[model samples]
Target: MIKLIAIDLDDTLIAPDGHLPEENVTALAQAQEAGVQVVIATARGYAGTKRFHDQLGLTTPLIVSSGSNVIEGRSGEVLRRRFLPLPFAREVVAFAQAHQIALRVYVGNEVWNNLDYDPSNGRQRTVEKQVEQMAEALVEAPFQIFVKGNRESELILAQFGEAGEGYCCRHHVYSDGISELNILHPKSTKHDALAGLCAALDVPQEQVMALGDSKNDLGMIAWAGFGVAMSWASEAVRAAADWVVPADAQRLTSDPDAEVAEAVLRHVLHVAKDKKSS
Candidate 1:
């Protein structure tokens, strides 16, 4: 029987507007009632994603910072942490400067920006504004803002790739349809974090399932026993997923993002139940 469900937040569990739908919440509660562990794995940092956890009523561990850190979801206690070295961090900063890209740096839940000029990297520039908006929301919401960037992310990724995943490097496009730095420790990833959680929970990888809708989720999707992709996910994500969940029919939601997620969640939960019965 499946013992764990590692879900991605942004486009997987939560709707695009950053709220969990009623159907999705009901599904989670049912999963819990059925004795399945529901966990969150996302690129969001502890301070950034904690509110969602509370809203979802998750009692399990969280894989945050794209697996850079693992912590208790309800209590907000750190279980494990991996961070990039200062030298490597500086290299990433230098590379962004050299490439004329704006960057947002994340260091242990603190977000810093060195944008002398506004961001100028095509779609990434749009992401910069989303980052700013998220930061602004945090100020009023009493949460942490890890970092925001308005620099060339390609340059940042070039450096991160050079440094390799060994430094816990990750790069993902932000919500505004632009790329941003989603860097983390080399060993820190949803895959590694799930493995760690599995070990702690005495569950094997073959018994774990994962659901997601983004490129950053590829690792966990690949790691899961069943990797279910959302219907509205990017082609790249869909191509990698083991199965695809259809969109929901009930269109109570008006937001496009939330609607897509609700559809996926509704379908994926059905899939999960089918798996258990099978």
Candidate 2:
């Protein structure tokens, strides 16, 4: 029996228009009622993921910042956090300056972003305090560092990623055609964080289900005993999934993007229904 579910938010659970689909809402509520743990695992901050946790009435810890930060849901306690080491973080700041690469750095709850505030363009919220000099604002080691643009830039971040400098890297592109590489502590993966949460909850890996759509989600999806990938996910991601949401799963949701509803309902809940009927 699947007892825990880790769900990615941006492209998997939330539609492009930014609304949670009606069917998804219903299915998650039913899952919670069925005593299954519904966890929101996203590459966003706690401030960004909290509203959904509240809406779903989930009491589980939230995996945020692509697993860099895990916080208790109800009391907002810091369950676990792995931040970039200060020396490496300072090195990153200097390197960004040298390459003129834009940076978004997280220092605890405060953020230092060089980008303009444009929520209309799908940018992170305006809560990020605009900073001209990253070195000046980065008082503490960052939980995550977002380097604008994809492709390794002259090995600036290779030390952290490919070179294995105690950090992990992820490449992601937004719907607006902008791409970024997120750098964080080496253990900062949804899979690693989920493993910790499962241990705490006493849920075996075999009883954990994970759903997602992006390559960043690949770790958790591949690690979960029963992994679900959206039908439109890349071939690599799909290959890792235990069950890829079929093309017909789109019909299970009014919002084409909330295919998670189908995975949750048919694969998770339908079994319960059948057992009761039997």
**Residue-level error in angstroms, candidate 2, position 154:** 7.4
lDDT per model vs. reference: 0.64, 0.79
lDDT of candidate model 2 versus the reference:
0.79
Please name the candidate that would achieve the greatest lDDT relative to the true structure: 2
Worst 10 residues of 1 by lDDT: 138-147
Q: CA shift at 31, candidate 2, in angstroms?
A: 0.9
Cand. 1 Cα-lDDT: 0.64
List pairs with backbone clashes in candidate 2. none
List, residue by residue over 123-176, the lDDT tens digit for candidate 2: 555635767676766677888877655543335546555435677667666775
Worst 10 residues of 2 by lDDT: 116-125
The estimated TM-scores of all candidates read: 0.73, 0.86
